[model samples]
Target: MSDVSTPDPRQSRLFTASELLGYLVLAAVIFIVLPSVLDAFRLNLFGKYLSYAFVAIGLVLCWGVGGILSLGQGVFFGLGGYCMAMFLKLEASTPENTSIQSTPGIPDFMDWNQLTELPWWWVPFNSLTFTVVAIVVVPVILAFIIGFAMFTRRVGGVYFAIITQAIAAIATILIIGQQGFTGGVNGITDLRTLMGWDIRPDSAKTALYFVNGVLLFAVLFVAHMILKSKAGRLMIAIRDREDRVRFSGYNVANFKIFVFCAGAAFAAIGGAMFTLQVGFISPTLVGIVPSIYMVIFCAVGGRLSLLGAVYGALLVNWAQTTFSESFPELWLLAMGALFIAVVMAFPLGLAGLYDDYLKRHIDRLLAPVDRMMMRRAARKTSPKAPAPTAQAAE
Candidate 1:
């Protein structure tokens, strides 16, 4: 009789050994190979892109899987970046460090804007621990409020998107208007160091790059764990048939809130990392335009594929940087065409195309070798096959 206790294939199919290998390979490329090859300047750019990849990763969960399109994910990203920036600015604005400024205790921008005292809100960011926690928590709190209100009221689709876009615009205006507190239209700049370590050095950039990569994979793993849970299945169900999901007795709003909060946390962490790697954070990166561009990263990467999202962020930004530097005036026109083509031709993004066409071919190519390996494994495991194996060989 066949082995009765064989484990169900469904139980482990999500992350088979080969699939895990793929993830490992990707990690090595990011952490090991890329740093070794690229110059300091190029690698720093890559590191910056990786920071944005974190935002794309959040989009994969929030927008792609949950069927929630947040046109203002940049809000969360900006919140995180600003949290880090606040801490860094505080460190740089010590009385002794900024003795030259008219007001030595506050950031130079504050001095420039004629502010004499640190704002109460900016005071709490003096603690690195609080700054780190605030990076994730502040965004989650905002997301929770928004998701709770909107999902509970069944306000969704384009209306939700419009509201988010509005939030981004408002945030931009507020940051610019609050010049002393937020550093105004210039945003935050002249960040000197992080905890006494000079982040301006080439070595620090490389280290930060690896740090970003590792954190990214950790986030990706967490997202995968979530999607593998019952809640994830419910997310897919809601995405497909919201009425059916609601009728099944699930708290649809709660699920939306949870996922949205999770996405915000992920994006927030990314924003913090971005600030660390890039040496500055600004209002421009937190506005509606950047938020829409972020969505395109998820869309082009195949929203359903987490790994694809990282790649999508990298590729899109790389293209943006390359084309803008080389072609300047034509870059926007080309980007518009690319977006149209992606929407019209590859609705599911690049991952969908791979699944639809390339994956089958890959399986076909590997089938014979896989079969031979499996047969060898089975032969070794099976009891009486030993004697028959010699006769079969003969």
Candidate 2:
């Protein structure tokens, strides 16, 4: 047999030292290189992309690992976004600020819609603390209810997806139909400032972009921890063999519920941050179509890899923005083609591509260097050889 030793199993771990080093490199790029290189507008766009990365990472946990695909993730995202939007609108609608409107202390759209008084539900958003709480809590509560109802009943597969899709549709309809209450068909717009600070400035955008980057890394760390825990293994078990997992005396439904709720919360936070950075949230982002597209982000990223998800969301969204601005109609066609290719050709997405085909080749390339180092170490540790053989020959 060849003398080359086998690869260490530890190297394949989800968060191996080398894997962590990769994250560190990526973090450096996000926190250092990109900010230094890109202008304010480009940086702001990247910040928006990072917000989408949150959703994609959450999807990896829920759909990729737990095998619970939710098409209504946008509902949670929109809820969180609207919560933040409500708070910003309230700030912008102060008595002195909106004196020109019929209702001096209501959102511009509300005043335009001829509302003389603030809506009851909009009251809580007046407090930033409550709005922040609601951003996370609302999505978790809704996800818990839906998850409990369906998972316990053993409702899953495509049926669960359809139900989620229905929820997204209903939410979009409610928002569009209730013009006065829900910002109507236009959705929430004309957002400005946060706690008296102007959000329109480039400096503010840069700060928010860094904030987005930090939160994204935080999410990645949490996700990596989850995947490294026992619960993460159980999630995988439940995904691949649900009946077996149930037979193993585990409450598969509860596990599913936990992951699903976690996923919703992540998506919600992303939505709230999106509002903060982009300054608006509309039905366009929270509708079924958009939610479906979000799935494509996860699918393209390699749903099994958190880092892949981030990269996938950024690449796809960047491409979408670039192509849409330039080609418009052709962008849609290209995106559709990409979605299909991901499903059929690259089933495991970019992550799998790296792990399966590329990784082994990379290892092969490095093996000779590793062997050379090993030989050098062995020689050093071994005793020194005897002196020159000329004396022995004599």
* Candidate of highest TM-score: 1
In the order shown, the candidates' Cα RMSDs to the true structure are: 6.3, 9.1
For all predicted structures, in order, the TM-scores are: 0.90, 0.88
lDDT of each: 0.85, 0.86
TM-score of 2: 0.88
Encode model 2's per-residue lDDT on 1-394: one tens digit a residue.
1122433333223454445555887799889998999999999998988888889999999999999999988898888888999998888888898899988888888888899999999999889899989999999999999999999999998999999999999999999988898788787877888888999889999999998899889888888889888899999999889999989999898999999998998898899899999988899889898898889999998999898899899889989999999999898789899999999998889988888877676556666665555554433333342354533443
Model 1, CA-based lDDT = 0.85
Pairs in steric clash, model 1: none
Q: Model 2 — which ten-residue stretch has the worst lDDT?
A: 1-10
